[model samples]
Target chain A: MARLSYLKALQRALIDEMSRDESVFVLGEDIRVGVNNVTTGLLAKFGPQRVLDTPLSEQGFTSFATGAALAGMRPVIEFQIPSLLFLVFEQIANQAHKFSLMTGGQARVPVTYFVPGSGSKTGWAGQHSDHPYGLFAHVGVKTVVPATPADAYGLFVSAIREDDPVVIFAPAGSLGVRDDVDLETLSAVPLGVGTIHRPGSDVTVVAVGHHVQTALAVADQLEGEISVEVWDPRSLYPFDWSGLAESVNRTGRLVVIDDSNRHCGIAGEILATAAEQMRLTAPPRRVTRPSGAVLPFALALDLACQPDAEQLVTAVREVAKD
Target chain B: MEASLYRMVRLIRRFEERCVELVRSGDIIGGIHPYIGQEAIAAGVCAALRFDDIITSTHRGHGHVLAKGADPIRMLAELCGKVTGLNRGRGGSMHAADFSKGIFGANGIVGAGGAIATGAAWAFLRQGGGDKVAVSFFGDGAVSQGVLLEAMNLAALWKVPVLFVCENNGYATTLTVSESVAGTICGRASAFGIPSSTVDGMDAAVVFEAASAAVESARRGEGPAFLECLTYRFDAHHTWEHKARVRYRPAEEEVSGRLRDPVEIAGGRLDPAERESIDEAIEALLDEAVAFATTSPAPDPSTALDYLYGSAVLP
Candidate 1:
């Protein structure tokens, strides 16, 4: 069995889709050289036509992908920096994402916005560091933040195959994650589906993106003390609310761990939804970056802004008391 | 060719006049950005292309949509927000589109559609065809938009067939090209090494000749071409300006600009009878379109959220 890294898994997914369908292609800045190694070997394998190197214009290429998708081609756009999503927010959220509905379903922009190295990367600083997946999910773009190697491969492949536009955020932290599995068994994971890393009876800890890995580690540390169910909602926009309900129904207590802002973050929504629809014994708690949280230049302060395992453990401990 | 151009400009002229009436009557919810002055540009540019060729329009896009062979009745219905509209009323005046007719859309965003046209042209080139050319119709205001400039670079690099038509109708709403645009519109294209031209946009014949040459070059795989059409807007930017009383362009400029009317220029090419027949035909067509639109039923509010997603199940 070979160990497949998350970045390699994403690369494989793109290669497989490009090979399977001729209309599928990748376009972005420096993808010809495969910046950050996400698009490595794609230019040589698929050639320059299929693998295009666009100018620094994020809005132009993003809308170009939408236009290409309108003309019967599937384009997968790679953004090296996460903040580029902010610059092209209108291009994605307003233009491509709204194309289908705006055109009365006549236009289906099957463009994939692949953002590798999302969130903080130590000294990347304020301009470069951002996880705007919550904004897309809020505006109803099919958003996915895969937490592992296998999930990255499966969700990315599925996003390209989808008829609508999808934004895939491959977190910088989880890029090194590896899964020991047979290459043939790696398959497509449908959107709006959630996965349980560890089933527990006491509390349901809903995690997103790379936070699932932390939730699992915390679950491991609290094994004898508390049985925690680590729930990873692979697709955020078309959120797996039903799958979440099933788990919260079993545990009767919930705690959401997310890297987004506290105000209107995924964690806040998870807690609110669990309270509204699911059976919960105690007031559901949430661990998130403070409202309007900006990651500072210093490493220590940057790490402080992101939700950590320590806060999750304390939230879990507090919720378990009820 | 002259008769068809005359007919199109006349049809657009009357269609816009009726649209203004509908706006005043409150039949149309949002007042429209009337394409009253720029009829010749749309008439000539569309006439130079094939039916399969695509065009992306701006907010003042009724003339382009009509010239590209969109059903007037359905387009009017769209402005009325009816189910039978082109986009089924989801996209209103600024976003009216008919994919079947190759009118990608009338976008609200100033220069956003340029890149979309470039992408379509890129796709067509990738498919190894010379028959198709994508046209992006914008304004003098869009000349400086970063995305439009980026799109030109891509189109030039890929040698894709894209015709960038800039209707330099003096004002980008209230701001004049002199006030906002610093450099020459043609100079911007020339810097990209793309072949460009400046034509009298008020005359259909001049616009047709310029557009025809550019379209021919694009079809020959000569990359993208730019056309800066120096025309004038005969109406307010939006019908809302009627009540808001925003005075931007001078009354003298309007008086002098109306001297070279697109309708009179195109109509002058034909005999008196031909001009009268074209005018009568357009009036009847617009009357029918107005009747069709006014009678069309609005879509149900309950289904407002329908088609928000193309997935099997809505989230």
Candidate 2:
């Protein structure tokens, strides 16, 4: 068994994919120098041609990735901040995402947009703290948010290998997580699948990205009182709806804890879909940031707005009540 | 070179004129952003390109697509939103594309094609293929977009084989270049270390000479070049103005603008008899193109998401 940190897992995935395929290249600002550490050791191994450092032009490089994909190359673009996704939304949604269909299947934009530190990194204020996987999912771009080290490595590999454009959001909260894993067992995980971290009969707590750890901890704390099933949906867009339904069928209750804003958030989609299709004995609940939340600069203000373990525990209990 | 350039300009002129007639007759649902005056730029640049070379075009993009070797009938069908269109009716006039011919697409968003072109060029060079250069055609208005500037930097930094063809047609939707642009346009490229040249866009030969040098430079792996083609629009920004009559340029300016029609300039290079024959040939080609476009069936509504993803469905 080897200890693999979440950040190291991301690096391994990039190293593996770039080595495995000559068409795989990495591009972003400061990535050549490995400023974010996720692309560490890639430039030295693959050389400058494969690992490119781009200018501070998110829209330009993002669309450039689309063009590269059209020309028969797969590009993994790294974004230093999660909120930079807002700047290049048009490139991803309008250009890259629409290319396959718009060109009548003549093109496939297999560009993986990698956001190293997603979600609120306490005190980073409004512009830097957005978790926009929901936006990508809404636009039908394959969106993934991996909680554990193994899942991060596996999901990123899958995103890179996908035929369409994929956005992988690596939450800042989950980046520090380390896990004991057998190196031989680590492999590419299929997108649109849910992994039950811990199974229980009482309630199914659907969590995303960093919130999966919180759900698992809450499940552990209230072991006997409320048996909790922690479900992590690796990919957001082609979400494991069937797997979610199966979990809900067993538990008969659902609670989604997502970090995005409440209105039109992934949590809302999960709860609404569960209510409509699944056999939920009680009304589902969601724990998310308030609608249109702008994370303030102060530590307390930022923490106050973000969903935490206590909120997840309370939502789990609330869903179990009915 | 002169004969081909003349033929392309003449073909584009006749093609656009026929397109306008179709618009009046209610065939082309959305009237086009006519490329009547900017023909030389497309003809000159595309003449310098290899068949495998790629190009991304702008809103007024018929000339570029046609010059890049897309079938005129398919392009016209695209304007008419038919199944036989280059994009199968998914892309209308503003979005027409023939990827097989290396015309990535005709982007509706101003200044967006530059980045895509740069990316394509980079990819081509990275793949160890024959030095395939990409040409991005945009208007004076595109100079104002931040993405274009960013693309210039990326192209220059990476030494991507791309030609940034800026068709300086004086006005961006009635705003004159003098009023809108603060600093010089070519200086933007110069700042990024991209060698640039300004040429007489109305003279197809002059544009061809400049583009040939730039395209040659890119093919030899010398990096990107920017060509600022000084030209003017012979028609309105769009056909909607045919009735709206929004006045911007004075009558004198309009008279002077039409003085150097790209078609006439290029056609003058050929013998009188040869020019007449070319015109007749172009007319016949346009006639067949219109017939093909109009008779083609419109695309069905059900298969809207037909090409959304490359892989087959999971089930």
Candidate 3:
């Protein structure tokens, strides 16, 4: 089996999809030069027409992708920064997402908004660092945060094929992670399906995006005492709620580790859903960033606010004890 | 040509008036943005367009949609939130659309449709299906929006076949175009090398002539064109304004605004007997349309989210 990095898997998915469907085109700033390496060789392989290089106007190009989609072209837009989503939120939320319902199902805006390295990156602070999958998920936009290389390849392909506007956030942490996998075996992962990374009975630690790997590693380290079930709800919007109920029903305990802000984030939504309807032996715990968190420029301050593996270890142990 | 144009304008006028009545009767839940005085722009612009040509409309877009050939009965039913409505009642009033007729949608956000039209033009340019053009209808208030300006730059740069029709109807909500928009509206388009002109939106023939020239240029791969249609809104911006009684402009503005009515201008171009016959036919059509919409059943509460996504799955 050949080893492929999460970043390479994403690039391969783009290359494969463009080859299979000529309607699949990309629009973004500096994507011709492949700034973040996700669009690394797309321009050369597919030419400029398929690999569209856009201007710095986020609002313009974002709605532009929607227009293209309405005219029978599937557009895949690349946002260089995560916070850029804030600038074009109206284009996605109001214009593109609303078309289907607004047009009485007469229109379909099948555009994929890909954020190459979302959330905090080493020393980048404030505006550059935000994992806003929660924002899209909350607004009913199909959101995917792939936890592994295979998942990245599969989910990206599925998102492009969906008949609605989809947002794929490639976290800053998972981009470099590599795995041993066969390219021929790569296929679309079903949306709204949760994947359990490791099997356990003591506590279910539901992690999203990059934290799936973190939860898996912590489960291995704490194998002697606490048995942790690491679950990743890959598609966050339709949110494998049934799968989550089954998992919580078995473990009878829940803990969510999400990178978004503590207040009104995906973590809060998951806990509320579980408390209201799902089976739970104890009060579910959530490990997340501080309220209204803004990552600082200094490395130390940034790490302090972010939910680390140490925090996950503590939360998992505390939940298991109860 | 004169009779058909007059018929459309009359149909729009009656449809909008009926919609206002529906709002008052509580049949239409949310009050609508009336297209009372700007009927000439929609009639003229759509008259110059082919059936396949696409258009993106503004919040005040019922006239554009109706002119582009949507069924008035279904459109009215949509406003009434009936299952038989054009958008199956999901789009409501502001977002009503019929893609089969190339009506993209009536956008709630100002100036957002220009960029979508630009992108649609790019697709048409790539397809090259013998002169398919896209149009965007916005107000003078949208001239200052960064996205619309950026779309003009992209359309000019790529030579996309798009016609930017700015319906300069004097006021966006309560603020006059002069107070909100800086500089002239045509200046914004010419800065990006797009050929532009300002026409009398009150006269249907004048607007049709301007649109024909712009549409011809666009279809021949000459990039985008801009037309600033000088018009006025004779009624309240929203139906709610009738009760709110907000008076931002002088009373004379309303009195003078009706002097050059588009309906009268187009109707005058026709023989008096032919105009009267068309008027009679339109009233009959609208009477049936109102009956069909009023009799249609309202959507069930359980199916409130049926059309949120085109595909079936959890929201």
Candidate 4:
């Protein structure tokens, strides 16, 4: 058994994919130097041609990746800061995402946009702190937010291999979490699938990215009083609705813990779908950031804005009572 | 040399004139950004490119698409939103593309095509293909976009074989180049240490000579080259002006701008009989193009999302 950190899992996924397929290349600002450590040693192994260090031109390079993908190369772009996604929204959303439909099926932009430090890093205020996985999901781009090291490796590998454009947001909170796993057992996890960490009968706790750990811990703390099922959806868009329905069917109640804003966030979508289609005995609840949240620089303010274990526990208890 | 360049200019001129008539007769919807005055740049630059080379065009793109060997009838059908169009009615006016003929696409966004051309060139090189070159054509307005600057840096850094052609027609939708851009246009490329030159865009021969040298350098793997074609627009930005009445350029200025029409300049090179024959041939082509476009069927609403994804449906 080996303990793999989330960051190391990302690095291993990149190395494995690049070694497995020559068409898989990494491009971003300061990637050759491995500024984020997710691309460590990749430059030395793949060389400059495969591990390209692009200029700080987010729009240009984003579209550059789209073009490369269309021309039969799979490009993985690393964003140092999450806010840079806003700058290249047009490139990814309007250009790359639309290429398949706009070109009469002549093109496939198999580009993977990897954001290593998404969400809040304490003291990194307004500009640096953003979790925009919800935006990608809204635009129907395959969006993934991995919670554990093993899932990180599996989802990233799947995103790279996917024929459509995929956005993998490696949350800052989950980057440090390590998982003890068998090295020989590491394998590709299919997208749009949910993993149940703990099966229970009272309530199903749907968690996203970093919140999965909180849900599991809360479930452990409330062991005998409530039977909690922790469900981690590795991929956000084309979400594992069937898997979620099965979990909810067993538990009969639902609570979604997410680090995004309340309005139009992934949590809202989960609750809405469960209410509309899924079999739920009681009304579902969601713990999320305030609507239109802008995380402040102070540690306390940042913590206050994000969905925490306390909120998850409270929401779980509320859903249980329902 | 001048006569051949003039012939291309005449061809583009008549081609666009027929396209404008198609717009009026409701054959081509969503009126085009007519390339009426800036014909010399497309004519001259495309004249230098081989059939195997590729070009990525812009919104005012019919000239480059046509000059790069797209069939006139198919292109007109595209503008008409017909099923027989280049992209089968999916692209409409702003997104006509014919990859087989080496026209990657005519993008609607400003300054967005440079990196696409660079990436395509990189792919060509990586595949061990011949030293095929790519040309990205944009306007003076595109010079201010940071993405274009980034693309220039990437092209220079990777030593990709591409030619960045900037057609400086002054206005980026009503704003003059002097009012919008801070530094010189060619300076943007020169800043990346890529060899850049400014040529007389109104003269087809000069543009052809400059583009030929740049294209040859790129084919030899000498990295990217940038050419600033100094020209002016002889028509409004869009045909909507025929009804909207948005005035930007002075009336006298417009008259002076159209004075050295590239068609007349290039037409001067051919013998009178040769010029007459070319004119007759172009007219006939335009007639057939208009007829075909007018008769072509519009795309069905049921299959609008036919190309939404490349992969087979997930079972």
Could you give the TM-score of chain B for each candidate, in order?
0.98, 0.97, 0.98, 0.97
The runs of at least 3 residues in candidate 3 whose Cα sits more than 4 Å from the true structure, single-residue gaps closed, are none
The model with the greatest DockQ is: 3
lDDT of 4 by residue, B1-315 (tens): 666676668777887888788778877778989999899999899999988888888999988988888898898888888888888889966788887888888888998889888887888788775988899999999999888788889889889999999999889999999999988998888799999999999988889999999999999999999999988888779989987999989889888888988887778777889889888888898889888988989889999778776653221
| Backbone clashes, candidate 4 | 1
What would the TM-score be for candidate 4 when compared with the true structure? Answer: 0.95
Indicate the fraction of true inter-chain contacts that candidate 3 also forms.
0.80
| Per-model DockQ against the true two-chain complex | 0.77, 0.64, 0.78, 0.54
RMSD, one per candidate, in order: 1.0, 1.7, 1.1, 2.1
- Each model's lDDT: 0.91, 0.91, 0.90, 0.88
State the lDDT of candidate 2 residue by residue for A149-233, as single tens digits: 9999999999999999999999999999999999899999998888999999999999999999999999999998999999998
Question: Candidate 3 vs. truth: CA RMSD?
Answer: 1.1
List interface RMSDs for the candidates, in order. Answer: 1.1, 1.7, 1.2, 2.1
**Candidate 1 chain A worst ten-residue window by lDDT:** A97-106
lDDT of 1: 0.91
- In candidate 2 the C-alpha lDDT for residue A273 amounts to 86
Weakest 10 consecutive residues of candidate 3 chain A by summed lDDT? A98-107
Q: After superposition, how far is residue B105 of candidate 3 from its true place, in Å?
A: 1.0
- For model 2, what is the error of residue A143's alpha carbon versus the real structure, in angstroms, after optimal superposition? 0.7
lDDT of residue B192 for candidate 2: 97
Model 2 in CAPRI terms: which quality? medium
